[model samples]
Target: MDRSPFPHHGPLRPEQVTGRESLAVDLAQRIADRRLTALVGPRRFGKTSLLKRVAADLAAVGPQPVWIDLYQLTSMADFAAAVDRGLASVVGPVRRALDSIAATVALRIGVLGVELTRSPKYRPDPVLSLRNLLGVLTSAAQRHDLFVVFDEFSGVANIQGGAGVLRTELQHHFQSLGIVFAGSEPSTMRALFSEQTQPFFAQADLVEIGPLSDAAVGHIVEDGFETTQRHTGGITSRIVAFAAGHPQRAMQLADALWRRVEPGETADMPAWEAALAEVRTNVNAASERIFSLLPTGQQKTLRAIAAGGSIYGAAASALELPPGSAQDAAEKLIGNGIVRRAQERLEVIDPLLADWLCRRFPI
Candidate 1:
């Protein structure tokens, strides 16, 4: 059997990743130069994959990569544990120091290689533990740079004084550490870094990740099919057009297309349609759940935008909504990262969700 060319889940390999090469290279170089960066983008837009590429590029010559994912963390204890976990995963000098410190504290490191076990009588303040760990790691940075990537860094908002704790601890290490704070929630991320009252205000440079180019998506599609002895038969362009440069969606459509054709078979019009049907079927339940969670006004606004109807024009009137309400709904959608302004037109950020909207509520 031929190896599958498309990855269905998780971050793509650093070399296998496409469309974000230049951006990744630039980010890696900046981090090596000891710059703090805030990387923001929509969920599943390959932000993690880009970070992985950055990590790979910096591995041999620059700081050691320490990845800490803060998604769904509920307290400072969880945050400290996450940091400990990330540190435990590192090799070389950092890992050896962690082992020695864990022994001294009566704690255990390298349990299952990624888990840190706390001693019953040796509980320390979570915030203090986090600060001490950073102190140790950043101290080591004087000898070997430490590049830290905090994925879903905005989730820290859920922990009381989380941002303050991080800011106070990390500020002192600016000269020695390279940090990239990344999150998928655009509005929350903006509030954390851009708002004057926020603790991280002016702390890091901002970088926004957008969709991949259509040409790049097409290249991935063609390469995947041709390498597997299957021909696209001119269907690659249609797949690219529908995917609208979304990194995951492009690979998803290509995978669906690949499943429809056998070795040496050409994917013609019928095969393309069948693949689309399959893709739609796979995402139907998810789309419905997302649509059901929206407010009525947002639902109406989404349908109008998906159908290419004016949100605050006759479409709003027909939906029995005032122009202002439509505008508010559109803005809310944009803030939530569900809809975006593309070329001065409102477009749904998720092309699959947009397709579901139009199909579920026809114009």
Candidate 2:
């Protein structure tokens, strides 16, 4: 309806964002206050998009925000290098911004981190290297206040005692930089900050990034349809409701429905239903492909969660499962973005997938 078919192929840019205005303002405030905030939610819930938008806003206000995508980095060694690269554009242009000699911190970060990448002969102090890197960033922060955001950082940021060390050190030494740890995996994020033994324990405020409401998404759909002079006729409301407010899927299903409509035409109930079936069929098939790949008890757990039942063991039930097994399955489910913890209970994060699971495997 928007002529571009909702653009769900990737995350939207800052100007392209619709709704979630209050969340944006809150994040901006936390960043400016130099408070560490964990942005946690399910995948494709717009975490990266919000981070990018916040980064742009932080830069505008004079804190030189460094956005580092840690998705490609699986280890602390990789983090040091990627972080240096992320800051190179801003920190590289100057020779001696700080009082120290330019030669002191002028080394290309990749080269400094190269030893960690070597096969056999490499021996380097990871903690010292990380300290030096942070020190350099601290020096740069003097000129331009630093707002560092590690996007999708769970991969490397959960390095057991290693990340804990970094967090402790930063809290002690670097008070000038505002750091934001953001990821799409809700379970992992919760464990990172909520667990008493974890590195980031109780250090940051937890911001649960929930899905957009049905009515809000409806407004978005109507706006998109109006741009193309097409009438939505309540079809968008149905699609958004089916999508369960997950932003990406809602937009994607809306896009899928729009493809069935001719130019200058409004979608009626019948046309919308047909398109919904087509979209659901594709989603179900894709989900089934991975269904067998999950752990043995996981399918049962998925069906249980989909059907709005407890995944834990029950003395009164034959489908009862061990607590350890249930927790394992829950971890995988949350990691895959299929389920998330809503307060104390677990629920399917994707509504369409939940409906599909319920219909295909009623428990």
Candidate 3:
């Protein structure tokens, strides 16, 4: 048993046992077929990590997979620049197509004046350029296929002022190419593609990335923590309970507990408590900041939701507020990744945040 610490951040590799094999396989198939796919989940649920794993697998099968993190891009120009950088890494016919467009557009590289040999300038209107670039890349790589994944796509929509228009435009331009759009907010993601009024309605298949099952979590605990302690099941169960099925939180809790327990020693109640405390503290601070930003009515509605054990009927009864107010506030919170409606109940996206809110406004 190797006593190595697990990575706290970044993409999870195939060697890692995160229990998302089904998702990876599904996404791989979609990419192989040159179909569009969308992954929806709450933040810290491993959306990005799962996509990276699937993307790696897709690239292995021949089509080059390029990943772009839309969170880093604030403006259209920034988004274009990031795409250019990502596309530059791709080779073969895709590279030729991009280069051809670069030559035709006379696209200049930034102040570096490096020219459009590999990277093109970040244009304010990157959609047109990206469309042209994708046209060439797709046409050139038609034989092999090219997969492009946009992570944090909801953030990109916010940057473009709602996902409606941008999703339509991107769907029109790149839906033909193998592409996957993933985001932590399911409501926003659904609105983009599932809603008929939206641009991408029914354009791509909707794939929900759910939590790792108990059995899978046990495997991850045993393998990733490198312990043959035989109590992997119990440890994994406790970790899942603490994280409430959020992948990132589960991993973080496991990592914390693993670090606290000494080699050859089994994880104990004390260590678990300590780890839980740390997670709660971090989540509380974040929830507090977000709660502070809400209007008085919204804050009251949230408290009522928490008191009622969910947001189902809290506004109508506990808060005595208009139904639309609650709905609107909930939508806003969902878009911001602060809250989500699941299992017919509205709750904080993060379990830790729920705990934090509970403590602050006790019923």
State TM-scores per candidate.
Answer: 0.93, 0.83, 0.81
lDDT of 3 by residue, 71-117 (tens): 75565555555566666766666566656656676553231122223
In model 3, pairs of residues that clash are none
Which sections of candidate 3 miss by over 4 Å?
1-5, 91-128, 159-176, 195-198, 227-233, 307-316, 320-324
TM-score winner: 1
State the lDDT of candidate 2 residue by residue for 48-75, as single tens digits: 8887787777677666677666775566
lDDT of 1 by residue, 17-57 (tens): 88888888879877877788999888789999999888987
- What is the alpha-carbon lDDT for the whole of candidate 1? 0.83
Which residue window of length 10 is worst by lDDT in model 1? 111-120
Measured with C-alpha atoms, the lDDT of residue 102 in candidate 2 is 23
Q: Least accurate stretch of 10 residues (summed lDDT) in model 2? A: 93-102
The residue pairs that clash in candidate 2, if any, are none
User: Cα lDDT for residue 223, model 1?
Assistant: 92
Q: Say what the RMSD of model 2 is.
A: 3.7
